[model samples]
Target: MSTSSFALRLMDVHVSLAGHEVLHGIDLSLTAGRWSSIVGPNGAGKSTLLKAMAGLLPVTGSIFLFDQTLMAMDRKQRAQQLSWLGQNESASDDLRVWDVVMLGRMPHQDWLAAPSAKDHAVVETALQATGAWDWRERSLGQLSGGECQRVLLARAMAVQAQVMLMDEPLANLDPPHQVDWLEQVRCLTSQNTTVVSVLHEVGMALHADDLVVMQAGRVVHQGPCADAVTHRAVEAVFGKRIAIHALDGQWVAVPKF
Candidate 1:
């Protein structure tokens, strides 16, 4: 296979937590500028896989980012190229939303340095992109669950990184807001930003360019999002309890019963 198009490649990657293995050896390659969605049942290690890719978890195998080993890159350099939005990210509730979003620029700033004009502009764009601009001056504690999720998304977007990893980004979002977030991700990918997301919503995962289906800590399926074989694998992993269907040109996973 031609590796030239891949941004990240994993070779025999394995991860363990609390002395119990979560991810079995996972070998995969993710293409640059493409959107990938990972789906699996509960405790299927979907989140673990994303964390490993983000270099947030301890793994024994090699993960090469943009042709460079993740281990070889310094922490700061890694931050310059990758951004992560974890599930239920904690924030200082008393902090203003703008200040919270500005935290994303820390990697680009010098010690004790003030926010630059560029930093402010980037934060503004990020906030607007996530529809969080109106709450810029509000306290984080004042926002609802869904609003907080958008603000956290804004912080991730402000990183200006080439690659982004997100876990359950739509957790607190309503249907309409979820659609908006999808559009935001589409726009980012158009700008050549690689996005890898872990989603429990199978229908939402279908919107990605590619799909990775996991079961028991291993990827059982990976291919074009609309591929029939991939859809079959998705059903098989769930013991055929959910049926994949096509409705109005969209794929949806509905319960078999």
Candidate 2:
């Protein structure tokens, strides 16, 4: 396939933090309109890679988003094109849920301008999609962890970006919500929005269209979820402490014991 076929492409990407190299020279190309998960042991640079792709970390080398140079894009353009949901996001409990979600529309708003009718409409849609519309008037502090996560997800959805990067998005959610999260990802990809997430939940990560297994700051494998090589890659990363198995038409990694 042509290089342009990929939605996000990296060439020799590198990152260092506090005088320690977190990512060795890494290269990856993720197909557009698909959900891909990055999975690895802790400190394997999975989150670092996700942050690099989100432009939050200063890195060397090239990152292309939809064939456009990522760093060259203007701030407003970048905001409109890419949305990021960081790990363990925190918000003021005093704020109303509706207002929190409305924050996502800030990117599309003009300087110091109030929200337009379209902004309200988009926020409403996002809230509904995340199942947080019913609690729109409630304070964030009043909601449980799972409920709060839904509101946060609605906020991210309000950005309406073509590419969404999520770091451990399943945080604070229960199993049902985790399934809902997977469904939401599928829905986004169906709408031709690219999604790349860093997840610690191996079973959940397997639900993605593709898997990017990282080990020691490098991509050890990249392929379809059902690919045998991908399964092996997952096992290898965990040092065979876990095994990937096909179960009920899905891929999951289980404890070897």
Candidate 3:
């Protein structure tokens, strides 16, 4: 694929935590305007890879956001180009929902500057999109686990970045809210945004446009989600304990007997 077609690229990427190398050499290219899910069994380093792509952790290889070297970009520039939603993120309990979402605008604002009108508009739209508008005045600590996740998602959406990296975004979300989250992701891709998520729910991960299957800290398969090969790879990584099936025109993973 042409470099221009990629939203993010990595070459020979390696990560280490606490004197232990977590990710091996990884080469990945994520197409722009597409949603890709990374899945693996426990200790497969899915989150570590995502963190590397986000530039949150030190990496030994090259990572580029579009054409720019990720580590070379200034903090503000990186923040404006890539938005991140972490798993089980903690926010101050006293922070109002609206204020928390507004924080997403920090990259676009001047130091100590008040929010511009456009920032307010974006935050409001994000909150409404996540169904958290009614809680705009409520504090973050007052919300349930699922509710907090929605708010954090809104905050990430409020950034309106070109690429979004989400780790376990569906955590704490019930089935209905999970469906809502899928819709929200679809809306993002419709606008040509690139979304990469690490999900533990195999069924939910299959909903993505493509799947990045990993095992033992290396990418074992990268292909369209509907492909039989991808399904086999997914099932393989999980020790064939799950089976992939097509149900009502959508793919789902079911437990193996």
Winning candidate number (TM-score): 3
**C-alpha positional error of residue 117 in candidate 1 after TM-score superposition, expressed in Å:** 0.9
Q: At residue 95, give the lDDT of candidate 2.
A: 99
- Give the runs in model 1 whose Cα sits over 4 Å from its true position: none
Compose the digit string of candidate 2's lDDT tens values, residues 16-125: 99989889889999999999999999889999999999888999999999899899999899999999899989799999999999999989999999999999999999
TM-score of each: 0.98, 0.98, 0.99
lDDT of 2 at 180: 87
Candidate 3 lDDT, 105-161, residue by residue in tens: 999999999999999999999999999999999999999999999999999999999
lDDT of 3: 0.96
Stretches > 4 Å off in candidate 3: none
lDDT of 3 at 11: 95
Clashing residue pairs found in predicted model 2: none
Sliding window of 10 residues with minimal summed lDDT for model 2: 244-253
Better of 1 and 3 by lDDT: 3
